[model samples]
Target chain A: MSNQMFHTSKSFDQDLTETTDLFLEMGALAGQQVAQAMHALIEGDMHLAHQVVEQDSAVNQLEVLIDERILLLVAKRQPAARDLRYVMAVSKGVVDIERIGDEAAKIAHMAQQVAADNSGTYSYHEVQHLSNQVRLMLHSALAAFEHLQVERAFDVMRSDGNVDFEYQSAMRALMTYVMEDPRQVSHVINLMWILRALERIGDHARNIAELVIYISSGTDVRHSDFETVQQAIDASKIG
Target chain B: MSNQMFHTSKSFDQDLTETTDLFLEMGALAGQQVAQAMHALIEGDMHLAHQVVEQDSAVNQLEVLIDERILLLVAKRQPAARDLRYVMAVSKGVVDIERIGDEAAKIAHMAQQVAADNSGTYSYHEVQHLSNQVRLMLHSALAAFEHLQVERAFDVMRSDGNVDFEYQSAMRALMTYVMEDPRQVSHVINLMWILRALERIGDHARNIAELVIYISSGTDVRHSDFETVQQAIDASKIG
Candidate 1:
């Protein structure tokens, strides 16, 4: 009887591993959608913007699928201890990814709006810089998840501050443009909204990175001082 | 040795239960603060607003306490299946509560701004009405949590639509007030910001309710149709 129980448990573990891999694939797809949205905005490619919007539905579907799978696993497999933590982390991580997809769609919508203006009134350069920063953060954070690399996750979290700063700078520049020529305020405000959405994408990436650190180290790094997270990351590298 | 292990597990479960009770108490306190913030806004009472802001530190401290306890429980107890789900839900619930506290403080700050105006030009009626609606939602949502009443949670989610409608109406009224009298646009805009914050609070409450359903039923009620959550709630009651 004991040997039979052991075999059953081993099979359960294997099934969970397979489920986790599927979740990671979904995360990769969501990350690619975000990057593509940014690229579309930078290139003023309306077709690519539409593609990002279209892809969001798939990401949303994946979120629901992963959520259902996690719930079923908990009910059936009764994962304990470390496996429990891993499942819960993936559940929350997918939420962050789904929100990132929403933010990307929001950016794409902004791109469409800019395209409709037909006035060539708004420049995409500032938005391009903001998108690049956010995309890099998303990529690094997802990579951290793939490797469970605590230090890389920490780097992603720290990068969020820079993205936010760039967003603020972009906002100020846009404000100045609006103030100088009030006629352009409407178009520029739309661009500002896109920049804000990109900034929010970075925030969601930071959330995922925080989750990664928590899942790997069993620590609640949120609300901790930056220095503490950094120190924890360094310690994790050695320990 | 088997007996000793059983005793240890029982003791750990008792500790976890106690920790969860404390978390619930903190949640109730946070809800009260949110209600008082709305009251302060409606009454134009800066003293009460300041009190709410000062008390926010307590809410923040409780959030950290809850996080620490959750981490400790997961590490020590290695709770399986349903117990693990409950722990994860509690952690996420505390986060929603913390955000609600932040929103209350934001409302208090807005109240302070309105009080500072001294213009005596802006009528507080619409703001009062909007605050009342938000307070009703907050109160109902907390009651649902306290009772574990799924129907009450569903009610809270549905109430969000009303709150949002009132908020948009308030916005429209404020915009008209500003356009009709350009001199007051700045003050009206500030008031609009406060209204938006209150609407966001309602959104957070809905989030908590969705989480409650998920915790109880292992269902991902989010992104699903309203009827689905309602049906889940009904099924849980029957079971």
Candidate 2:
């Protein structure tokens, strides 16, 4: 290749790497926000809860920044085929990460309310366990994306089922609480919203995992059953 | 411009138009699904509820198709500046629309559960009102997007507050049922989930409205307070 062509291609690669790095930075920040929100919820730390809410703007800013970078990258490079897929995957992944941050902020807002209402005291054990599982799924999902590890992505997908199971158990436990003392209904509902947010966080993480598989294998596993996703990934491997 | 250049530009515009038409089709379908889901929930129509669940695949298919078209458009046309923003806006809008479809299916699933347990009957009056508001917001949001009407987008954004208020009132009403008779906790929770889905649908619609504003004015109003968004749009108008 000519020197000018070589230099242009090299810079395009650099631009892609830099954009991916920024995207991952956003993912990591979102994960931290979720963790802090969970901590605030369990410990009833109003200060930390407030912090999580405030820090959500940082994630939102990153989303805006990364979005611009992707648009510029596409405009300048006009990458095709796999390169285009990778850019599109990152674009979608940024949305999921930003949503994860939104969910974290939501959990923090509920934590503040829960803290203020001392009468709403209920068991945090289930909530804590479920949050832990969700955080891990998110963490691993990002890791898989960073490294293009399809196997790890599949693991995250499988673990989403466990999150769902845990969510159901927690819901049942809260229902039992409401049954035992109907007055706790208001408080239990708040906890239910928090659980619901965590469940959604898991779903977003699973979406990222699906994007990872799509980026690596060029297969659209979204809207597919687990068996179908697994089989598609396996077939991609053999091919 | 040379005839060749003019012909290429015209074809690019045609491609853009075709892609946008498909996106609007998806949005229309999603709105219908949400409306149908509400009807199913209110009337306890098992067949309609089942049909909503099955029809979700169609929405999902449209999402996959739209994604591919957007990717190809970007790759081939290499849209820049305002053109790039429009493409990206449509791309993100598709995600929000698909989520609306998912939420509708979720409502349908809960409707099935409510239909199975006839004794769980509670007042659907508040739920119906909330669903109607959410559906209107979604429909207006899409219309705003299709027409690129910033004023209409602002209207949709402003209405989201009403949806939130309605959601809270519904929550309190459900809490009353649980408190009056704790045995109704399970049934109340089912209704709560449906309400929650409707509220989320409202959120997704608001997101599309944000995209509409972004596409038209080149100003992203996401993550902004309503007052700020209004001010920004007004300033854009004056400038």
Candidate 3:
């Protein structure tokens, strides 16, 4: 994250910097895919949804490229201590970004399915709200990662609680719709799947934020902050 | 997996062997948690379900320990070529194993919720079958990993299709049940969550099998096998 974290070799530093930049670019693309999928879902635009699906290949390709770069960087340079941790975290964290891309593509596929069905009875307001929360979560997490902002990373982690709350609300609302009209069961289930993917995207974003924290502080902060935030999230949900 | 895959470095070999053993133990425990969660759902065994939930901590701890070991081994030994690939695969593969643990814990939580409801009218035969398929899939994948059997790994990847099919069938059946009587919507939804976790467990297993093939043959087998297998899985769902 910071410029001076490792100083053993200049090439290793450049490789690390380039790899992180590629990961950020991939993260940004994934965020766009999630947004575009939601746009297509909301506006009933199958064309954009198809584009989102097609774009996922680029994200996957980036992951493979990042992996190859990491393998070369680690094998050739042999980073020690903090430098090694940074490479390891980036290699692992990029997978989360790739999976976030998968989730986005899944949302787009559901959009395509709904578009094919040609049903205009549903508005998908809940999905739109939750996915916006998810996008913000991922965006902030990526910012924390790019800048190595520990405070921002914690903020992103705290924001994940709100995103999860939105996800559960969306699921509950979809369940209510299905219960109201059994004929809409299929429609509601499709939206439910989209919501599930969006919720998971938020979770993955939180994982990335945790990675930033791990890299910055050299301490794993997984369950530490989340539980307190989760308790608050749950209490807010109940109240 | 072969004897001569990596050059003879006794301590690196020992570290690799020990790290892999930890991963296998984590995988097996995740498999058991999944199975026990289903058993608790079927038999209404709240005690076993609670145990499954509690046991997830051990799995998490194993992942952390394995990660620490991996970081140390990679930094100290600086393994090259095949050895480096093996370490990378194991490091990434272990995360899948950890996620499998999360899915199992999720299933157990759903079991706990259903058990507290104390309703005996619902039989989870479909879920039982699907979770069993998932367990076997993961079990085979881990065995393939431990023995470095490329053929067996391929078989595990192929078997993921059946698990996906079973997952769709279970979802369809649950949808029908909920549509038939909306009063049982909550019950059906709970079972649906369990099935979703089982489906993801299968997906994770397939990812691990991919890792096994990657380590064994020195080639990434993801897009190669999954595209072909996914089509069959999708076709089976329709027909």
lDDT of 3 by residue, B1-239 (tens): 33345556777777888898898899988888888888887777889989999998898888878888989999889988768888899889878988898998898898888887665356778888887788888989998888877667778898888888888888887877776777776677788888989888998999898887776556666656566544443443354
Q: Rank the models by lDDT, top first.
A: 2, 3, 1
10 residues in a row with least lDDT, candidate 3 chain B:
B228-237
- TM-score, each model? 0.79, 0.93, 0.90
How do the residues B77-143 of candidate 2 rate in per-residue lDDT, one tens digit apiece? 8888777888898889889999999999999999898989777858888889998898899889988
Q: Which runs of model 3 end up more than 4 angstroms from their true locations?
A: A6-8, A118-122, A225-239, B1-8, B118-122, B226-239
Q: Which candidate achieves the best DockQ against the true structure?
A: 2
Cα lDDT of model 1 by residue, A1-239, tens digit: 11111235776766666666776777778778877877776677999999999989888888878776776676666666556667777877887788788888878887787778655466788888888788888888877876677888888988888997888798778766755665564466567668767877888889888877876766667667788887766665576
Across A181-212, the per-residue lDDT of candidate 3 in tens digits comes to 76776677788889899989988999898887
Best by TM-score: 2
- Cα lDDT, model 1, residue A220: 61
Model 2: pairs clashing at backbone N, Cα or C within 3 Å: none
Please give the lDDT score at residue B52 for candidate 1. Answer: 94
Error of 3 at B187 (Å): 1.9
Two-way lDDT contest, 1 vs 2, winner: 2
Which candidate tops lDDT? Answer: 2
Question: Which lDDT tens digits does candidate 1 get at residues B1-239?
Answer: 11111234677767666666766777777778877887787687999999999998788788778766765676666665556656776776776677778778878887787778755487777877876776677667666665556677788888888988988798778766655665564466457667867777787778777766775666667677898887887776677
lDDT of each: 0.73, 0.87, 0.81
